[model samples]
Structure formats: C-alpha cells, structure tokens
Target chain A: MTTETTPARVTVGTGDPVLRVRDLQVSYGTPNGDVPAVDHVSFSLQPGQRLGLIGESGSGKTTMATALMRLTRPPGRIVGGEVLLGETDMLKLDEKGLREVRLRDIALVPQGAMNSLNPVMRIGNQMADAIEAHEGRAARKGMEERISAQLARVGLPPTVARRYPHELSGGMKQRAVMAISTVLNPKVIIADEPTSALDVVVQRQVMQTLGRLQEGIGSAVVLIGHDMGLIAQFADLIGVMYAGRLVEIGPVDEMLTDPRHPYTRLLIDSLPKLTAKGKLVGIPGLPPALLNLPQGCAFNPRCPYAFDRCHQDVPAVQQLAPDRRAACHLYPANPALPALPASVQMDAATPLELTGPAMEGQEEVAG
Target chain B: MSATPLLELRNVTKVFQSGVRKTPANMTVALRDASLVLPDGTATATAIAGESGSGKTTMARLLLGFIKPSEGQILYKGVDITKMDKAQRLAYRREVQPIFQDPFEVYNPFYKVDHVLTTPLRNFGLYAGEEQKRIEEALEMVGLRPKETLGRYPHQLSGGQRQRIMVARALLLRPRIIMADEPVSMVDASLRATILDELRKLVSEFGISLLYITHDLTTAYQVCDDIVVLYQGTVTEVGSVEKVIRDPQHPYTRLLVSSIPLPDRTQRWGEDDSAITEEQARRSTSGCRFAPRCARAMEECWTQIPPLFRVDPDRAASCFLRKDAPVLPSEQVGQVLKVMRPGDAGNAPAA
Candidate 1:
C-alpha cells in the first residue's frame, strides 16, 4: 500500500488516487470448503491513470474486478476488503447506496458483448435505460440527443441507435456496450476483457474509444485481460496476478524492460513479439490450483530462481523501486533483487524443464 | 523446392447459401478467387491472416476437403484433390491433417482421451504395431508427458494440455502439411507460446510445412515464413512475413499492421480518421472488397478489380497503388472475371 503514496519516478498522473483497494479478499463457498478466489490484493488508481491487470484464467483477475464493483454473484463472497471510491467505502454501502454509486461513480464494460446487450431491446433504449435508472425520466426529449452523443463518442454512427443488437456487427455491438456503460460518466471504469473475441483491427478501435472516453471523463480505469501486448500498449501501470495474488505491480515500461518477479518475466518472454521472431517460450508448469496451493510461494514449482526460503515462507509484497512492488524471495527488503541466473537471462526460450529443486513431489493433476 | 508445390489452391472460390430457398440474394461468397502455393521439399509455415468473416476459415475448410469449392481446383502435388478417387482421397487425407480451434469441443466426452490418439492410428492403418511407442513419441515431441496425458478423460485435462494432445495426434500421422486453424486462440495466454513453439518445432524438427490460419497477426509474424492477408474473401497481400509486416504495401495490410497492439510502450496506435463501416463493405459488390474501408480508395478502386500486382519479386498487393508494378501471372485475369464489367476486358492485365 506504501507504493500508492510514493511519487512515481515517471509521471503516472497528478492527483490523489480516486480508487483504492486495500487487502481485498474474495472466496467461493464450495461443498468441500471455502476457496479463496482473490487473495489479499491491494492497489490504487489515480484519476485518469490506466492500470492493467494481466493474468491467466483462474488467476483471480475477474474475481477482483467483480469484487471491486460489488458484483460478486452467489457462491462467490467478498470476505474482507476496503474498496474506497473517493471518500465512501464501497464495501460499507447498502443496496440502495450501492445502486446509486455503481453507474454514477463506477461502471463496468463486461466481456461478452453479445450476451450483455438485451436481444430485443433497441440500442437507444439500452443506453436510455442506463441513464434513466439513475436519472429521473422527466427530461424525455433530451435523452435521445444524449443517446446519439454517447453513440458518436465511441465512433458509432447515430443510425446505430435505431437498430437491434443483432443488426449491428461485432465491433459495433462492442462500441454500443461501451457507450451504454459510460453514459453516466462514472469515475471508475472496470473493463473486463472488452476485446477478447474481437479481431485485432476492431480491438484496436475499441481500445482507442475506451481510452478517449476515459480521458474525456477523467476517470481511472482498471482494464483486465490475458493479452500482454494489449496491456502493455494501453496501460500506464501494469499489475501481474498469479494464484489469486498480485505478484508484481509497476510502470509498464519498467515491468516490460526489467521485471522483478520471475513469473512476470516468464509471462513477458512467452508472448510472441512483432519486433523480433524466434523460438517461443512458455511457463513450464501449470498455475497452482487455488483450492490446493503450495505451502510457500505459489509460483515456486515453476520459477527457475526460487530458493530454499521461497518454499517455506510466503513472500509478502515488497517495494522494490519507488513505483514498483513484487512478491518474490529473489528481492529482499535491504538488498534489492540480486542478479538472476544466466539461463533466464539468455533468451525468451527457456529450457522446457528448467525449475528449482522445490518442484519435487508436486503432484501435477493428470486427466 | 520441387517442380510441383506440396499443396496448391488455384483460383478457388466457395459460396454458401444463406437462406433455405436457393436464391442469388441469399448466396454468400465465403471465398473469392483465393490462390495459394506451398512449395515442396522444404518446410515452411504460411499464415492466412484475417478477421472474422474475412473468409480465412473458408479457405482452411476448402483445403481440408470439408467442403467443395464452387470454382477452381485444389491440387496436391500437381494432382487435383477434388477429382481423386477413394484410395487417392484417403491418401490425401493422410498427407494433410487439421488442428481445430476449440480444443474442448473436438473431443467426445464419452471416451477417454486415448481414443483421440488411437483412433487416428487405426484409421490411417498405422496401429498394427508399435502404436504405444508412436503415440508416446508424438506426445513427447509436443512437450506432453505420456504419464500425465494418457489414460485420462478429456474433461480432466486443461485446455492447453488438450490442445497439445491435438497437436500430438496430428503429428502421429507424420503428415507432410498441417492445417492448424486458430490452434492457440482458445488456450490460456501462458500456454499459447508453448503450443506455438510446438507448432514451430513441427517445421524444423519433423520437416513438415504448416498452414497456420488465424486472426492474430503477431503470432503469425513470430512463427511463419510467409503471410497471406485476406479481407472479406479477397487476397489483399502475399509476401514474406518480414517484408509484409515490416513494410505493409496494401492499405488493408497497413491497417492490420497498425492495428495490432504491440508490447512496446513507446509506439502506440495512431488515431483512425476514416469511418469505413461494414455496411459500406456489404454494398460494394463489384469493386475491390476492401475499397469501402480502404483509406486509399480511388476512382479505379470503385469499378475495376485490381489483380495481385508485384510489389517485389516475391511480394504482391491487390491495390491500384501498385498499378505500375508487374502483375503476377498466376490466376490474375481469370480470377478477377467475376467483378469485371461487360466491356472491362480492355483494361485487363497482360498475361
């Protein structure tokens, strides 16, 4: 949490953070027992700052996003956390208060555009419903103009308002969804993989629209996705999640250039780059199951540089630089991170079986 | 390279009827005059890059013989596959294999995962003996341990694991060419690189050519030797990955290259000014398929269809910007005949 107050070496943004999440914990109540989907994760976002949370499936990125908006469904409960949006604690808000704060203060651009939009509802009605839910329906004539403006904001033509969801293309539907979510001009936008199923060109256009809207509204954004390239290109700050934990959080340039966490480094290296082409590298073992995690560090079984201490004690999130934080044994508080092994420094393509001695007896689940 | 290409699609086009009734209004041209060549005697990976509805999948299905092309021929080693008999068709199926997009849907939940590996062996008549050895070798080649993957249900394995097993199954046949359609799109991000690496290894280690069909251009650029960029069933650009990605000549190719979200922070995506809607693309029936969305659309682009003009010795782009460049002699005039006006023969390129 100290990293939130620290003046970043690079000018991330100039303002007190509008959204702060402290020790956020979310769990799913299963028949066997309680399974923590999101561990004690903490981060803050200054107004107009773009924070990208990158993780693989079941890494708790979506869980954290839903929890921030108090949208955790049944079986998934927010056990502990303080979601401070401006001055009010979102966790303390009642249903009525939460509804008011949701769209007016915080909005969500959900992943699947096809399922998110109502099939029968016209695009303009969908946008109107979002506005009329918070704003009273007295100003009926102005709603049409507002709807067209929102549509035009995301690059959709005004004619799109007359059509149904099925009538529009995939990109148009996604842009329409964006328009609906931002109609209220919320202070924080939680876009959960808005471009997952879209094509590369359309994905670019959608991201640009989101960026432009965020800038116009001066809202902090928490963009969650699995694509490393997309996160790096759009976000100012990057947060890498693993096994329901924020393994590393830092500036995008710094994290990509010199990553402190081993998982972050391996994940970055795994991505196929446009700048260069070579043998592709992927993380060796599968991510640890959330229900049955390793005793010490969750990533110990796959990390090449993991040592003895990493297997016995869980590493707390430690501040490595003025603006960066990582949870790894390689970087102690007093001496910063030591030099990594030569094997990891060589190329993106690490040997298939490169792992520390801690990997012994880890029962990898078989099909 | 050999005298004949390993597999060649000579001016192929596929049209699908959209409505229950047989009508031209309901006909959707899934593919239009798409041609490709995979040289023999050398291992290469060629990527067919396009977005959804761009006819990339149609081209893949055509090559795999899942559907017949309405026009042109699909040749294998200079012999037409569509005209082949039962024995030749079986042989052709063995020579070319497919790795589908969704790893989960491909498997039947009723059977254990081993059925996937063994059934192919039996069908190809390679399971008479040493079946276990061959299966293990294929799995190991794709970085899957036989102990972890074998004797398990498809549900028990991860998406990445299932995809790797599919790659292993494809390898078991020792096919000359593997047609992988979006092989890694369904897998997790961390596992995508592993699957792509395995696909790359099939080229270098096993001496097999790869026809990688996907919308993701970054991965294509990373692993492929050459690329064919398609836009709404039309082949817009074809060249080596280096030349095409580094310096895109076609306007559509340029848009695609610029649209990809790279990892580098310094270079961000430029703002798009042109408003090229999908409706406009649907309306343009005769001109270049991408002219509606193309930033460099001209008067000629609206009427006459442009052939693949030679940007370089090995590169070609279907754009009027390359009008002065020599036209590729391969299926140029014949392929564009569908879009030609009644008296447009005078403007046709010299063969």
Candidate 2:
C-alpha cells in the first residue's frame, strides 16, 4: 500500500484520524443465516473531536457502537471492512487484545447502564474494580484516592463511593457509570443514549458533566443517541445513521441548519419546535428493516426527495459543502437533483425567533 | 356553557406514605396544591416536563386517579373525582385511559399483540365482533397495519410497533384523554417520529386530549401546544408552549429548556447550569422551589411561595417575577372545595 493511502503508525490527534471505518458491514444470523444490520458503513473520528452516531431503532447505530466495543457476540459478527484505531486495525484484533484496548484505549458507557449496575456493589468499589482490571500492576497505590477524585469529577461526592447502586438516584448511577467509563482516561469513549432514561434536569447535568469530562480529558466521544437536540449540542461533527448506514456526516451547524440528504432534512424538520405548535409534521413511515433493507437508499421509501436513482442505487456519502458529506442522489453537485417536497423549514416559534428572553440572555454567546 | 374546564386539577396534593420508614415515615408528595385548566377533549396534547424528582409521574397517576391525593381534589367536567367511589372511579378510568411508557409491559408474555389490544376491550365490555373492526382501525391509527401486527408476540415486533399497539389499545376505548408517560422514550429513534405523528393525528383527527408526560423537551416542543414545568411537587411554569420555551420567564423553565439538546448548538437556548450547585440545591430551596438554582434569586423569594400568574391570554407561570397572581377569593371557591379518601369506596383495585 502507498504511504499516503495506506495505514501508518502515526501519533493520534496529530496525523491520521484516531479511528476510521471504511464500508464496515455487520449483520445477525437467522435460520436463513446472515441478515445485514450495518450496511457498508464508513466514517472516521479524530482524536479530540466527536462524531454522533444516530438512527431510529433497528438502524444498527447501536450495533456499530457495540462492534467498536468488540462486544458484538453470537448471531452478530462483522461482515466486512476496516475498523482502524490509529495505525492498528481494530477489527483485526483478537478477543484478548481487544479487551485491553476496550478499557485502556477506549471505553463505552452503555445505555443499559441504568439497569446494568450490580445492585449489591458499592459505587466506589465497582469503579475500583474497573480501575484495577485496566491499571493492572499499578492499581495498588493511590487507587482509593483516585477513585474518590473520579467520582467527584462526575459531580458525585466522594461519599457516593460508599453507597450501593440502589442507594443512588437514576441520574447518579448513570454519572457513576460515566466515571467508570472515563476512569482509565481512554483515548475514546462511546456513550449509548446515556441520558435517554433521565429526567430533563438531570439529563442536562449528566450531559454537562460528560461534555466537561470529555473536554478535560480530550477524548473523542462517540455519543450514540436518537434525540436530535442532544446530538446537536454534544457532537462537534455528526453522522446521521439510517437503516445501518451513515447517511450524513458533517459539522453540526451545517447538518442542522442546511441539511442536504432527504432523510437528514426529514429528521431535522420532524423535530417538534415550540413555534411549530399546530404545524409540526412527523415523518410519514418507519425506518426500513435491517434484515430486508429497501432497494437503493435505505431511506428512499421514506424520503420526500427520493428520485429514480435514489430508488435504484445505494447513495454514497458524498461531499456537499467543504467538510460536510451526505448520502443522497440530490444536492448542489447534481443540478438535476430532484426537488424535495414543500415543507416548512421553521415552526411557529422558529429557532430564528427564539432569542433574548427565551434563551435567558444566553443567546449572545450561545451561537 | 360556563367557564368550567374540561379536565381540571384543583389544588391536588398526593401524599404516598410507604408502609416502611417508622418514626413518622416521610410521605412522598407527588403533587402539592397543583391546578391546571385543560380545554375539554382538545386534540393538542399538554406536555408536563420535569426532572425525575420533579414528580411528573406522580401527576400522571393523579390525573389517572391511579393514586389518590392526600389533600385537595381533581375534577373531570366539574365533578370531584377525588370523592368518587370505587365504581365511580372505574367509570372515570374508562373515560380517562392510560398508555404506559413500556408498551411491552402492557401485554401478557403469554399472549400476542392482538391479545393485549383486546384485553382492554374485554375489560371495558367492548369485546364484540364490532370490536374486531375497531381493533383494525386503532392499529391503522397508530400506523400499524393490523395484519402485519396482530398475533405477533411482544418479542416478535419492533419497539416502535409494540408502542404503536399500546397506543392502539388506548384508542380502542375511545377514551377522552390519553395519559402517556414517556411513551416514546423506549422506542428506537427512526420510528419515534412516526409515533409522534400518529399522536398528532389522534388529536387533530380523533379529538382526544393527551397528557404527554416526558423529560425530553424537543419532542414536547414539537408536539405540544401548552406545557407545565413541574418542580419538586409543584408547578413552576404553565402556559403556551411557545412562550415557555422560546422565552422562559421562570429560571427553572429556562434551565429545563436549555438543558434539552437543541437542534442548533450555536443557540442552545439556556444558561449554563453551573450555578445550580449541590449546596445551592440544598440550602437555597425555600418559598420558590427553584430559588436555589435561579441566577437572579432575590431574598423575598425565600419568604413566600408564588402562585400561578397568567402572563398572557393563554399562558400562566408560577413565579414572583411575573407578579400577577390572582388568588381566587376564598368567598368564591370555598363553597366547592373538596377532600376525599380513596379507601372510602372499598372497591377492589384491578388484578
């Protein structure tokens, strides 16, 4: 392989991207065997930047995250392609080597953390176990003090280390989970809907903590969530998944403000706006099944801008604006691109109108 | 014809005393002197947003009368539901149905999707051949084609399909109001919009009032017309969805709106919540539930609780900053005040 295009041992956060996946495919095993879950998905993450992984249920976004964690098990396997973490290929790692990389090099805060916690374990002890498993020979000295500091970093008092999972509130437990996930200070963190089950207030707290922690440690966060709003704020760059494929990926502002893909545009416009009130319009159909994805673009059947080419060929993630890419047959490049259906870009209290008092004067620095 | 509300909670206060915790076991107050006026059977759902401890679920249970309030009353069409006997409560429940958050839990593992949808039919005495046709319509209403859905076990269907079935069951009863507590939170993302769209269709087409309780604000902002921001056992803000969201007057509401992941991060709509420290969370709390977290908190805010003040023709918020409380004259509402016990009816709860 040529040095320019081939893999090379370059320092992370400086040279090549931290992680790159090219046409990575995954699927489940049925009686018929091998149903595609992730269809030739491709995206790359830089060391200090975040890429939001989003999709509806059965979209395979979670499956992709699980694959990165190497947690994908029976009835599920990587069907194809490269999962490169630095110059070392991740998909190529054996089970044992993958384990080392999981906690020490990267970590995941699972969505099931809400219930996955062992009720009997003290919050601090559980964290200690994680630290010990990864810290290996060095875990003996200052582990307890380190654990206390980590808990405090996540907004939990050091005393929380003494309490069992059940004693803590749902939000607290999630925060504790975050603490353990980041305890190793891995280069990457994959959080799967970490705040989906939380209350609005606590959701904010957890997100702020996660955001701050990510910034402090300078780890690239793989925030997997369906809530467009959370993804909008947390993701520096976004990858909108539809039916196991990365339909769109770009800077957050570009994707949210001026969407190119029909599915991406549909997803943004479908979000309930305060001003939309009586005018809110939800997307018409469900996401296509992974086992039997629709022909051409997976989102074609549900897309308002689907043309003949969209229905015939799988749309590739093509660059639209600089640093912005979307998987659609229609765009500025394709002057003959079919026009999207007439839809309201803004609800009654459009985001444009939401300024000053509505934002509590946070608007000045908000944008 | 009078100014009576379609569904009203008049100073509703629910106190659940756990059987445990001796030495005057603390009672959990899900609601405290809460009240709201909902237009009868308005299709536009009213969103109740709050943090977990803010008691949004307790309010749902109160609205459904699943649990009785320790004090005050809940009125449906001007009739006191708090005082309703067991049989009366059952009839009231029929009119005010609930669609649970986890659609899978609503179904029996032993039965198929059809079985769960039909259970409400048999319980409500609507299990007839005509009910069969109604089932199809309800399924279609939730965007589920009956043939693809019926007979499938809860395990067989997708999360979105199961939730749709749950919505179908609620629709089957033709209930006047649907109490959905975080209904779509569990469903996968791609299908969330479809369910939300279906809920919108239910109101615009079916004219069913929806009390949508959730912690997510973007979805609420997308779907609801009016909203109430709940604090610790209290209503902090209540008014038009646009006003409360676009320009929240209450610090709590502003915090809540800002906490939400907005579609646009550049304009992430609220204050940085660093000010709401744990010490502030503990010591700053007083007359105003959010005084501890309010950046503009004043000393008087600690002395007396503010009442809900109508900020405009269609909105009301409970904050001294609004300064427009019109406490109903004791002479006017005193005669109609009610206090009732759930145990008085002695009707056995559903098995």
Candidate 3:
C-alpha cells in the first residue's frame, strides 16, 4: 500500500492511512445464498478531509461503513476486497490485531450512533470504559485528563463528562458521542449522520467541531449522510452510491456545478429552496432495492433520458475527468441528451420493467 | 381569495387539566386566545411553526376539532366546529379532516391499507356502487394504485406510502380544510416531495385550504403561504408565510427558523440573541414573554405585555419592539449573526 501525503489528495499509505477498502464486496448469506450488500466497493482516506458516503437507504452506505470497522454482523460476511492499513490488511488481521485497530487506529461512531452511549452511565465512565479497553499502562490520573480533554474538545463543559447520558439533551448526547469518538485521536473516524437529529445551530457547531478537530489531528474522516448540502460543506470528495454501486464519484464542486448523472442532478434539484418556494421537483421513482437490482442502469426505468440503449447494458464507471467518474452512458465523449424534467414525478408506480438498450450494443445490463 | 374564510380560529383558548382531581389547577395552556382567519382560495397552505414546547401541535388538534376549546370558537365555512353538538359535529367533521404526523398511527394494523380510506368514505355514505369512483380518485390523488395496494397492510408499505394513504383518507371526505401534522418528517426524503406535491394540489387545484403543521421550516416554507409562529401557547407571529419567514420579527420565530438545517452548504445559521432561553421559559412573563431573550429588550419591554401589533397589512408580531419600534440597530442581524461564524453554513442567500 502506497499513498502520497498530499494535503488535498487522499492517497493512503502513510502509517496505516486511517482507513482503506479495496474491491470490498459484502453480502448477506440468506437461505438462497449471498446477496451483495456492498458489491466490490473501494475507497481510501486522508488526514483532515471528510469523505462523504452519500446514498439513499439500501444503497449499501451503512453496510460499507460497518465493514470499515470490521463491525459487519453475522449472515453478512466480507466475501472479498483487501482493507489495508499500512502493510497489514485488516481482513487478514487476527482477532487481537483487529481489536487493536478498532480501539487505537480506527474508531467507528456506529449508526444510530447517538444512542451508542449508555444512557444510564456517566459520560466520563463511558469514555473510561473505551480507554480501559486499551488503557494498559496509562495511570488513572492520565485517563481522567484524557476524558476531560475529550469532553472539552467537543465544546461541552468539562462537567458534562460527569453527567449521565440521559441527563443531556439530544444534541448534547450526540456531542458526547463525538467527544468519545475523538478522545484517542484515531487516524480515522467514521461518523454516521452525526448531526441528523440536531438543530441547525447545533448542526453547524457539530460540523465546526469536526472540522476543527480534523485540522488538529489531521485525522481522515468518513462522514455518512443523506443530505448533500452537509456533504458538500464538509467532505472534500463525494461518492454517490446507488443500488449497491458507485454511480458517481468526484470533487464536491465538480459534482455540484456539472453533475454527469441524471440521478445526481435530480438529487440537487429536488432540494426545496426558500427562494424557490414550491413543492420540490423530485426524482420519479424510489431507489432500487439491492436484493433484486434491475438490469442495465438502476436509474434507467425512471430516467426520462433513457432511450433504446439505456435498458440493456450496464454502464461502467466512465472517467470523464481527473477524479470524476459517472456510470451513465450520457457522459463526456458520449452523445448529449436533453435535460429531463425531474418534476414529472407522478404517483408512485410499481417497479417499471427495465427494457432499454445496451450502452455499447451489448446484452442486458440487469443481470 | 374567496369572500369568506374556509377555516377560522376565533380567540381559541384550550386548557388541559391533568392529575386525579382533573383540576384546572395546573392546566397547560395549549392554546391561548389564538385567532386566525384563512379566507377560502386566498390561503393556499398555512404552517404552524414552533419548537418542542411550543403549542404548534396543540393548535393543530384545535384546528382538527379533535377537542373543544375551553374558550372561543373555531369557524369553518361560517360554522363553528367546536360549538357543534353531536350530530352536527359528525357532519361538520366530514368537511374538516385530520392527517396525523405519524401515518401508521392513524391506521389499524389488522386492516388492509384501503380500509383506512374506505372506512372513512363509508362513514360519510360515499363508499358504495357509483361511489367507487371516489375511492379510485382518492388513491389517484395520493399517487397509490387502488388495484396494487387495496389489499396491502400498513407493514407492507413504506413510511411515505402510509402517509400518502392518510392524505387520501382526508381527500375521500372532500374536506375543505386538511390538517396535516408533520406528515413527512417521519418518512424518507425521496418520497416527501410526492406527498408535498399532493398537499399543494389540495389547495391549488382542489381548492381545499390546508392547515399544515410542521417543525421542518424548509418544507413549511415550500408548501405553505401563511405561517403562525407559536411560543409557549401564544401567537408570537402570524401572517403570510413569506413576510413571516423572510423577515421574522419575533425572537422565537427567528430562533425556530434559524435552527432548521438546510441542505445547502453556503447557508449559515441566523443566531438572534433574542431567541428565548430555557431559564426565561421557566416562569411566565408579565410583559412580552420573549423579552428575556430579545436582543432589543428595552426598559418598557420588561413591564408591558406586548399586544399582537400589526407590522404590515397581513403580518403581525407580539413584541414591544415592533410596536412603534424605536431607534433600532442599523445592523439588526447582529443579534443572530454574532454566534454564526463565516464557515458555518446554515443561512440561505438573500432569496
């Protein structure tokens, strides 16, 4: 594993570059067999940059995040992909190595992450518990100092560490979890919608704290959320996942200004603006289920631009520019199509049959 | 736009008495002397925006005619919903139906999905034979297929689907006023627009006035034209949504609007110093309740209970500052913008 320590680029390699996943395919082994929850996913991390994992539910964003910390539950195994950290691949690491990585190098702010903190236990005790898991030689006094430092770093008064989780507000609890997540100053931090439940003021403050903290430790951050606005603000790189596949990957500004995919355009256009006072022009259909994904492009069925060629062939990641990729046949070098009306979204119809044409005149892409 | 108001809350005051004695001893003033008039056709969608302890939900219950107001009357199409007796109340209820915040909460898990809508139509005597068109129309209105979903249970549908059915239930009655409370907050984002668009049709095309209650300010502004900002059971601000949200004069109103997280990264939070504090909320105020948090609090503001004073023809704010407002700060945004940093993007541009 080799990574360039560029301030802007997330090329992993330097001393267990926080987190790394390559061709990571995760699937649920149901009675029928394995259904890909995360199909051959790959990504890397860098210090201080927030990598936003954006997608609708069932797009495998959650599963992908869980796989990073080796926290995927039973029935869902990491079938493939090498998650490397420096010289060692996390998947190949023994249980003890995994334990060390989980605590020191990679800490997961788990999904439904706000409640991960014990409500009945004091915040100090919770942090201490995490510290005790790896606190072999540190004195009790040192641990206390670490706990207080963590609490203050997240903008909470030092005494908040002494309060029970229940005693704090929803925002406070979220902040406390953030406090615990960053205490050890791990190389990588994976936070799942850390500010989803918080109000705007607190939401900004939380992200502000994350940004400041990121700058302080230069820890590579993996932030997960549905709202693209938050992603655009914090994340340097944005990976748009759809139906268990990366539909579009690029720089935030690049994606926002010139989205190559219709789905990406629809997501941004659907955002109801205060200035534009009206019901949002939303994408016609709901996200496709990972269990029975459609042939060809998952978005082809609802896509207005889908012509004779859209339904048959699966479009691979086409690199339109440096660091920018789109899976739509209508990308750079491909013939252009008219801008589709995203608002023509009518009643929720049953899943439409995927019967469009091939991207390169090939067989059905739905298989 | 209509000559008469489709829905009206005339000095509506509702008190909830708790405890074994069921006394008014510790009655929660759910709504206090609230009054609003939504002229038919003119009022597209009206929003009741407030924080957790704010009386936004209580006002919704009143508008739905779920419970009688202790004082005052609720007028819908020249009729009082709260004052109506048994039979009259039932008939009147058909015209003013409620769509609860949690869609599944309104339906019985044992029954089919269509049962929720069909049951209401049947009760209203619009469920049989030729009336079948009404069922299909209701389903079409909410974007559900009657054939595909008629036999489905609540668990079978998504949160967005369940909520749409709830809206269809109200549509089945052909209600003039539809009271929807936080309908999309519990649902997924992709499906929210579908439901929101349907609500817009209720007012625009169908000509039904919508009393939409929500905490999400974005959707509130999107679907609603008028807004009622509630604070501790009082109407802190009320008027057309544009004037109220775009230029919030009330401290509580400003705080609530500012607290909502926007999807745009360029936006920053509006931190009005006047946003009432928790300590200020503990005890009721003699003057303006928000005076404690009001950045423009004056010596006179602390003593006199500020009456709802008109700022414009359609907008009003219950604050001493707006009542013949004196020399105010040139930079009025300082109160809110003080806490907001350059990079903290919560405020949308001037739009």
**Fnat for the candidates in order:** 0.57, 0.46, 0.26
Candidate 1 ranges with C-alpha deviation above 4 Å: A1-12, A333-340, A343-367, B20-24, B275-285, B332-351
Candidate 1 docking band: acceptable
Query: Which order, best to worst by DockQ?
Result: 1, 3, 2
Give me the runs in candidate 3 sitting further than 4 Å from their true place.
A1-17, A111-114, A335-338, A341-367, B1-4, B14-30, B40-43, B68-71, B77-80, B256-260, B265-305, B325-351
Q: List, for all models, the DockQ compared with the true complex.
A: 0.36, 0.24, 0.24
Question: Pick by TM-score: which candidate is best?
Answer: 1
Q: Which candidate, 1 or 2, has the higher lDDT?
A: 1
Q: Estimate each model's TM-score.
A: 0.91, 0.83, 0.84
Question: Which is the winner by DockQ between candidate 1 and candidate 3?
Answer: 1
lDDT of 1 at A124: 95
Candidate 3's error at A48, in angstroms?
A: 0.6
Q: Write the per-residue lDDT of candidate 2 for residues A1-367, one digit (tens) a residue.
A: 0111011211223546777878898888888557787878877777777778777666677788888877888788888888877777788898788878887788998885657678888988888888777767588689789988999888889999899988888889999999988898988888888877776667777887887687678778889887787787667778888767787888777778777777777678667654454444556555554555668987766666666997789876777766777778775566433456468332211111101111010000000
Cα lDDT, model 3, residue A301: 68
Candidate 2 achieves a global lDDT of 0.71
lDDT of 3 by residue, A23-127 (tens): 898888777566787876777665565688888766778788888888888888998998876566889888998988885777777544445988778899888
Question: Highest lDDT: which candidate?
Answer: 1
Clashing pairs in 1: A367-B152
